[model samples]
Target: MALLSPGRLAALHQMGATETRVLQDKPSDSYERGYAEDVDHIIPSPTLFDSLRDQHLVPDDMPAISQCATHLELLEVFHSLRNRVIQSRYLDNAFNIHPSKRIVYHRKHRRQKKVGKELRDTGFEGRREEKWKYYLNIATARFEQWIQGIDTAMNDLEIPPCGRKVLPPLDVLVVWHAFLLNPADFKEYCLKKRLQHVQKIIFPWREIHEAIDSTTWRFTVPADQAGWILQTTLLEPDLLHTLTEDSHINYLARDLLRNLSESRWYNLAANLRQANDRQSAFMQTIHAAINNQIEHRPLVENVQRQCIFVDKMHAHRWIRSPAVQGTLTRAVDKYENFLELFRLYPNKFLVPTLDVDLVWHTHQCSAELYRGFVVDRVGRFINHEDNISRGTLDTGFTSTEEWYQLRFGEQYQVCLCWYCEAILSAVEEEEVKDGGSWEAVDVEEIVERVGEEVEFCRDLEISRQKGRRLPRWKHGAGV
Candidate 1:
């Protein structure tokens, strides 16, 4: 039986946490209904498993007991679980689930079209890069404030770590989703900031979606919960007001900072900076800066420096570019090859550049497809380990570069961009100086934290699919 931690149990008892009432949902939209139906149709039958068993595709070490089910049978169970998770987390209208990359790419395209048109309409005199940067600067600054708001909510809720929940605005959720895709950076940022709630808080995605109506893009809080939330947090009681506040943008974060200071929400604005003295001084400086009317460029640069998410957002912009779009198919092909390399040598860890990683992320979004792909091609479940240290990641990347060159007769560095090149060179230089010290470090602590499924001792029997060649790319990726 599972046991709760003493601290958590006490928190739950003190807070009087109640089970959420299951509210009946309204009829789903056409797209949502269709998607749910499609998922339901994918559920496999025992007869299908029997055919696979006859074909020697699955292990048959157990009798037909639910507790002692075959591997294929377990797969069916997990598949059904996944369907339930999707239904509850997504299709049930509890939370606003952001579109996958497939759908999101189109949304991004539309956003770009809007931004470009706005630029033209305003007669902004700048290069294409400058125009895009202008938009990114505003967006990232807004995202930084949104993160602070989330922190405020998390800290205010005096409940167990996992029990505290806040509904993020849809626009904020979009940025947060991108931030999470780079798991290492995201985890490290939260840990470094001592954001325990941010790190451990359970996202009631369906609930958040339901709270925010999809058609109107408006939000509502349950009347019973709203009172407590308003009293405990800095947020407005009416979620519509919070939504409006989130929709507002500030390029230098001047407006947001002023509001925080005015409300005496110094701790939240200071971002959990531990020392009382430091927090006070920081808040004073911010207040003085606002009063003095800080220069635009310096404040913008400062915001950019403090915003850890800007880099990933910038990287995503490049990924969504037409050049990357042209080469996406090639990147997917490379990603398959990367998986095949893992299949060939299961003991070693590998790392992908941003381009290939994008493809890997998209595949994993479709849980069923990802499982099938890895099982058929790699012969085992290839888990994506997100929490990794920089040292470990660099080592894996360097090793992958060498292995890829030897196996594919090609350089592993796909992007010729200055930032990518700098990273590539820095890793190589560090490797030379350290003399492969990373290999000597405790790998389990730093590298990919994989599960017991990784078989290193013996070649496990696999239902390998027929191999095929992917078309070669004439151009480099990660523009």
Candidate 2:
């Protein structure tokens, strides 16, 4: 397996698919004849960039795109290219269908029986803490595969260098979605890998949301686009079959899976027969330390960090509990206010409550949707950065809390969990000691401190506000 480069395997895969298609069409009894006819189809298909550009040759022929058309609309219409009409409709849709809303969408009958079965087969069924360990391990492994698969596909296949992107399978998409939430980390990963397809990759958020057939549970795309995906990536299993029958990839490229299994860390984490009690505890602590450093690092180096938090939350039902109804509703309301806050003070470094963050993260899972929704409302792209230090987060959260309340007449620290409560208390105490107030965020200083943190920050032309402090709210006994 090691002898065959990914490119060679890709060529073979293309030939095999071409041969099968020819045989099906020709009803060939002779293998030789079918193989000979397969030569024509094996020629590289036009890249997605070419296909999209060809589709929109006549502007009049293009379909009516969403009013909130931003990059998503541009990619759909001009294969490249926002609006105010989009503000109401797009914002409503973003909040309404954001991924986090699905956390409790059908959890009542799904959790203990269905979800448990899913995790059970993945070797994560166990005590709460222990389950986190196994879920993290499997998630991390899958993320590794995704990164490699994308890199390999881009290098080997004729995927567009900068255009509409091909979607990966759902498991890979989950981790990819999380990774893309941190734009800096995602871009750094691309830059470090020297990946050319970074510009070409665009998630089709609108298409997926609108085109999915509920009865079939299938995302319906043009047959050409589906064929493009089959030709370009290793995501061959039927989407419906994947959803209803098995969430696991039973037919993953054997060599790639073998290499993943051979890695020492993956082997240690996945070996179900090993002494897991102590090992899981040890690995869990190590995972925490690793996450601290890799919070905003490249996916290749930080797959564990990328997957662990998400998988851990899922394992504990934090992201999928039926009790999430009110929380998600509040999240949507708060997310609307959060966007409004940004529109009012576009230059401010306002932090969000956990509820708002949840909604924000969900919106971002679909990159096209997020860009269109945010750009329409805020007049610029808002990158959700999580790589800031604890001190920075505390200060920003505290100041943002006050500013949000002042602007919206609502409390921002809504989560009553012990962890959130403790953090809020500490930030409030620190503010009192310093006699601090909500000051305007230093746009230049922040940009310089975090290089390329916001890809479009410099391009957008941030307006500097006067350093006037907002009215302060006295906490507990006055200092």
Candidate 3:
């Protein structure tokens, strides 16, 4: 025979009284309540042994024999006799069903409704009952497992330092761990659950820094959750400072800064002093002189009015200051030479004395020259009086005699003033018509013309060897 512990006996007696009161005060309308109370006593009977067994609190090695069976039957009788007490305490008060079990119940009810409609429509009711039983068994098993899980989790809860005391809610611990795993999802769950006034514990900065540096830190949090973490904790500072100080960090700091600032992480801006400083310096140098002369003129005037204004004589004296005159002259000369070269070959050269080949390699000559000269020439050529378009010509005469014979006639004498003058004037007119634009002419045409001229000169040389002496040619003079 097994003896009950004092505590277990007390619990059983308490349950008895609670069930007794529930039965005595039971309303006539609640047949299910009475039925449930009877079922509780019949199946997992609410006796001390039954309660111990259901709770898994019974020790092993207890014999299931005649005396034990007698004890179990007697315990079942006691549970029925004390039904009202158990009903009041556990049956009436507690839902006596897990939430997962409740969900299963609703699901089964829906499935049953669907199956009932189908059976009525088809007149096939044979499998309906079987399906219901199957679903019921599955639901029952799942409910039991869910309850077991809950019990195990409860058992794992740390005992208070002082005997049995109320522990923190299990949901709170769940939320904390969920936040550890994924703060973003946890935050959403909290919002959906309407858990108001939940005070989140702020993690220590060093711990957070370690988490970030570990390379395994989860970045799955939603933007809002990240914003919350940054706002409530020191995460923003740690992240901003880490990225700011890291030499290997990419040029994405600006983007990060923008995101942080937009999210109201204003403190991060403080750590970006160096970046801001560099940007300020660049802006100042790029637009400073213009800004000073125009936008900030009032301030400039104020400074000039307040400070000593040096006259031209004083400026000259300052310019001729022995301390800097030599350096200044050398710098000015270097700058002047540079400007001249830039004007002459604006695209090809930056510095006058630098080797031409170096500048040619450094800059594109055609593009620069076109930009500086051709663009300006377009406007000038449109306004010019001489309508002569640019033309290309090539000549390859070994002697002046060949050139004269080609342009004038082979028999033409220098004494023919009209012809000679016309030829000279035509050459002058051609030069004037060109507007001095080198790019306007066709280079290919010029090369072809030069090749033809070279061949003609060779023919002329052969003719001279054959005793065909061409006269010496001149423009507007004796031939």
Candidate 4:
């Protein structure tokens, strides 16, 4: 028989069966002169060898076992062959077996067979220690491979120093070899590294300490070794408010001021007068309106608190008279123009578009009461020059197209003026029939109408927010 392959020897060691016997007698011995020990099976028992083979405990190309005198001699001869195949096959098989089974196999078999009768005489404690040592060696080798895998994965990512370097958990290797392999679980292991907590783990403790010691790194202060750091250090609400005020983008502050002004809240009005004496007349008017609308109303009164204040009697009178309606309509147009100016430069003012809309809607509704003033006459004689002029005004490159190019550095333009003009003309004709002058409309009512109109426009804009109508960029297309 051929000598056992290294893989078979290792498998024998793994299965706790290493004893092999071959029949032999010295010719010089008188007692054994006529007798001979017959040749029997060598190395691992047939049952154990079958188990190892079924579990793929040895490499396929390894030779079958042959008679040998000692386990140590067998081990030496086995290791002399290409040990790579043996080591690889052992590791590959070991990973498939349950960690508990591996532990038990080593304890009951490998050491007992290697030391022969001495190990068999030793108690379970001695065997257990031997098993632990065996596992430690295997774990150390496996850990080296685990480290290599981590390094390989990291290199494949090729992330820059400034960019994120995601690291897999060391625990994953422990779990993978200890338990059944799972492809799905492996993917989840990768995702956890990208999160904030795991990202912190990638930095070495020494490097973290060095960063903490640096005076220039201002955001976080180091905590005592035993204590937890508070994340709330940077979340000062008062400081945030101050920053917003300094930046002039405090929308809440603007809204509060607007509401106080529109409702004519006198205490607030007095406070504003003291605080900002250089306030514009427009602001003063808004403040006075807020005071009258909100502060003066009786608590028990059942009247609807109008979102925008308007003179009801004046609105009724305007609705009755065409001349009044025409005047109200013109006032609505002017209010819209003022709103558009502010909308185009929202950042310059602290006011929100919603606030502008609120004011505009109130004014528009008041103007609507004057609809009786509009005339519904259509002229049969058309002036071609007027048509050409109107067409030119509507057709000339749209401001929106020019603005789009300026803002986005793209030449894509969709002519919305055609649609805008149609809407504007319809509103204009309707306004002429209601009332043509601006002064006849109540200022309060116009403000109310303007507010409502702004809200309507805002809603329309939001509905269209997701659609991107811009054309694709072409070569040589410059702004």
Q: Candidate 3, residue 433: CA error in Å?
A: 36
- Model 2 misses residue 398 by how many Å? 2.4
Best-to-worst ranking by lDDT: 2, 1, 3, 4
Maximum-lDDT candidate? 2
Candidate 2 residue lDDT tens string, 10-49: 4434543454345334333311222222322211111212
| Model 4 weakest lDDT span, ten residues long | 18-27
- Compose the digit string of candidate 3's lDDT tens values, residues 174-282: 1122122222333444466453322122211112211221111121233453443333321221221222343333132433323322232223335356544434332
lDDT of 4 by residue, 1-479 (tens): 01123443344333211111111111111111111122121111222223222212222121111111111121222122212222333322322211232112234675474432223333433333232222222222323233344344445544322111221122121222221112122223445434212211221212122222111111122333112111111111121122124333232224433343233234445445434322322234333334343322321011112201122221122111212222333334333443343345343221112212222333221111111111111111111111124344444325534543455454322111112222333345545766874334343443333333322222222222223221221223211
Every model's TM-score: 0.30, 0.38, 0.11, 0.13
Tell me the tens digit of each residue's lDDT in model 1 across 1-479. Answer: 01123443343333221211111111111112222223221211223223222322232221111111122122222232222333332111212222323212223565464322212223212222232223223233344444565566666745432222454433333345445444455566667666655644433333443354321224455665555443443233332233223333111233334343233333445543433443333334334333333322333343333233334423233221222222343555577778878987799999987656655654443233445657887898776655567899999999998888888876566542322222233333445667964444332321121111111000010100011111121122111
Q: Per the 3 Å backbone cut-off, how many clashing residue pairs does candidate 4 have?
A: 52
The numbered model that scores best in TM-score is 2
Worst 10 residues of 2 by lDDT: 455-464
Two-way TM-score contest, 2 vs 4, winner: 2
Query: What do the candidate models score in CA lDDT, each in turn?
Result: 0.38, 0.40, 0.26, 0.26
Q: What is the lDDT of candidate 2?
A: 0.40
Off by over 4 Å in 4: 1-264, 273-282, 292-479
